[model samples]
Target: MAALISGAIDLGGTKIEARLFDHAANTQDMRRVPTPRDNFDSFLAALVGQIRWLEQVAGDPSLPVAISIAGLIDPRTGIATASNIPVSGRNLSRELGEALGRDLPLINDCMAFAYSEAHGGAGEGAATVLGLILGTGVGAGFVIRGDLPPRHAGLAVEIGHLGMPARALARHGLPIWPCGCGRDACNENYTSGTGLRRIAEWAGLSDPDPVHVAGRAATDPEAARVMEIWADLTGEMLYSAQLMLDPQVIVVGGGLSNIPGLPERLTGALKRLRLGQVSLPDIRIAAHGDSSGARGAALMAKAGKA
Candidate 1:
């Protein structure tokens, strides 16, 4: 008999990815589709269609399904809030499950990334892992002893929304900018890929692509200055995180993490900010890359079954 498989979906701002995987987290089949940003009906249809397609392809009609979404779901109310997706204030799991005629587990994408890393990715041997995502935005999740801590009202680690340190802002001579979350000087406004682009633009760089900006830092004085400020701001945040969580390893995943020498730069920044004689945790790139979210969602479904 074939081993049982689980279905996983990673719902992002621009796309939705679905996959079929086994207990070992190996993908059996995968599919991707553009997300319907404004139409709820289209969004539901997209997800339902993908799952049905995967089921047909795998020849398994009863596989458990799990979702990793870039948003927060209130476990108490079952309502979800995703800025980019159209499911804000709706019971996504219930509605999506009803559409498919099966219950489905949903998790935050950052948490899923963290779980995947903590289990067998970059943080395999560590007792605690901090999964930090520096994508279009910033977000983090913590995994302790192979499990995620209980979240209340979907509020676990919202470090992105925290206020940026005044010292770092003043040192960089950057203005306090408003965040998408309606707050000024939030860390996401400066530490994410979007933030990097904004910083580059503020530094008078016509090219605001984060990758280009980071790549040109060695040659362009303006780009180098922007990188320095970005690194300082990010390093300050990580310093606070190190003090609070002290995870054995910090696994960085997202678009910005792919920049070459990012970990080394961050390490240098951290070393400069060191206050005591304590050593810092290992900073490693995520092992699973883009697939970590979907794969982790599948693992969550498998764990739920056991």
Candidate 2:
């Protein structure tokens, strides 16, 4: 039998990307289309049209489409409860599948990231891997061997939304800042790119961008102090996650992960917070970088399931 093609859709608020991958989940072709944010129908139309376009390019109408979205979808109900997108609080996949005349496989953005890293990227060969995103916003996912841990009620490995560590909070004197997840003092509020800038603001720095702060951390004493606090906060978060998931490697991704010396800082903080715990996981950066989600979604297309 001929190998199947994997059609992947990475949906965001602003645009929808359509790509085709070979059996090994390597990209063969890709294109981008603007997202329709007016309503669910428009959103569905955007994605469905993109999928059909990809099929035409592949010259194979049987290509399975896999979708990656921001929030987790309820597996039992097929309901996608995403934020920032117009289709939030709706069963997007089932509806899209109905329109497309096929059973579409879907996964959360974070889960896709983890799956990509675990299977062939940074976490390859590890028994267990944690994909952590310190991106524009913080997120995380867990992959055991080559599989993602089963989620309960569409919630799994959402370590970033957990409350700020009490110790880190006490030491840093951070306020109860609001989070997009409708919570205050969440890990994402401190561990993400905005979080780093927030720390700069609290420290009275005029430049609230992470790039500026990271650039100055080498020579400016105050920037170093901010990073120290960030390290402490991230350390507590990772240590707490380790106590629960015990992953063999935590692969860090996202914009802030590009900050030089961040991996070292994160590892140093983890060590300081672990209380000398044994069997420490190697903290690492993502190998696939920004493409993990699309690639992993393509993998799901080939797998025929999440």
Candidate 3:
């Protein structure tokens, strides 16, 4: 039988990526464009152009589309709520459907990561899997039995907003790690790439870049202090995850996941937090790097299920 073609959309704060994939989830073609500014119509138009490009490459206008986007979406209404992008609180699936003259499946970006990980990444063969993304923000998804994808109920696991004293200490209520969604301590304020910068500043180091600060942490005492705090906070978050789902594997993705020593530091912290005799959850960096979300979005398209 001929392989099926699928289209995937990854809507990030800074860019929107669309790609065409085959049944094996190999990306056949892809394009990425900067996310539009405040104009909603303009953003839609930009996305449409990307889709058109993918269509031209794959020669399949009727290709099944699966979407992954930052922020929260009401699974029932399919409305996307993103603060950084222009499409916040809008029903993206409905909008795309209206534009393309057909319905499209939309899932949270983190859920897509979990889906992809379950299929081929660290979560393979795991009954319960937890996917964690620490990028411009932090988010999570729980996959059961590696097949039954979790429903997008507007509440799978906004783990970033799990609340941390670090958030208030660093962001000081600024839009710095904004979480008006009313969750306390907001984990993103400390662990995200942006949040890590805040941690650096709080430690009296002036490096405004997360990558730079993480690098400095290796030699600079103050910067290392900041990382230690981040490690503790992240370890606590993982412990929370371990207690709740007892996932067989935890796949960590996003920009911060690439920072040197992050995996070991977080793992060591988790070891310190161990409860009586429970086996530590196997934790590892996502096999896919920063492109994990985009790739996962493509995988979602192939699966054709949310």
Candidate 4:
């Protein structure tokens, strides 16, 4: 008899990853592929290739697959809008089913991260979990107790697109940058990796990558100033979540979380921003790196079938 296996796939703007989970729910085999550059056909072909590669490694045709992807997933239509990737607005689930001769489950990438946190990661057993992805762009998802089957109307949160505080920008003397959402001064315009470059450029610094800027902050006052600006921007926006939802724990994920001093910088900023009677929630880096999405996607796939 073929062994039973479940899989999770996380597709982002730059890379795509697929992971297989063992019966014990431990991650087993993993595969990765570069995201397609442009157009739909090449994108679909790349995704199909990834599935085929996973199957080959597992040597089992009966396994189930789940996907966590960037973009808005329409709860009604099951359509996804991966605007950053070529596969935007495509019925990825249907298309994948056709190619693999089986159904594949899909969930928003940030939502998957949220699910992982709520179910098994940092947010486990917490009253409320606010999940954050601070990568190419900012994304958010949330979980509350007693919501059986865990379904939101497919639009829960998107913190990155929030308008940047004009006063903060002017105080720091940074030029405005454009966001994909056709807005100037959106939070993502200054907080994302690309956004970091724009901030550095405006500050007349040669380097803009958050990792490098973080390293330079201790020795260079300019880099420290840039980091302070980011901390302020992030902490200020995070306050919105605190006031609105009052989650017990806020989990931070994505590429930037890997930076060394990030946790200290962000937590200190949070402390500085807390107002009277608004209890500050515990903020920590997401335990899982990129794999959190895949793990949560796998869980979603299991729940969807159940």
- The lDDT for every candidate, in the order shown, is 0.88, 0.84, 0.75, 0.77
RMSD of each: 1.6, 1.9, 3.5, 2.5
Residue 233 lDDT, candidate 4, scale 0-100: 76
Model 2 Cα lDDT, one tens digit per residue, 83-129:
76787778877788799887777788888888989888999999999
- For 30-59, candidate 3 gives per-residue lDDT tens digits of 788999978888998888787777766777
TM-scores across all candidates?
A: 0.95, 0.95, 0.88, 0.89
| Candidate 3, lDDT over the whole model | 0.75
- Give the best candidate by TM-score: 1
Expressed as tens digits, the lDDT of each residue in 58-155 for candidate 4 is: 78665677778887767677777767778667777788789878877777788788878777788888878888888878888887761223565566
In candidate 3, stretches whose alpha carbon ends up further than 4 angstroms from where it belongs are 1-4, 165-184
Top candidate by lDDT: 1
What is the total number of backbone clashes in candidate 4? 0
Per-residue error for 129 in candidate 3, Å, reads: 1.7
The TM-score measured for candidate 3 stands at: 0.88
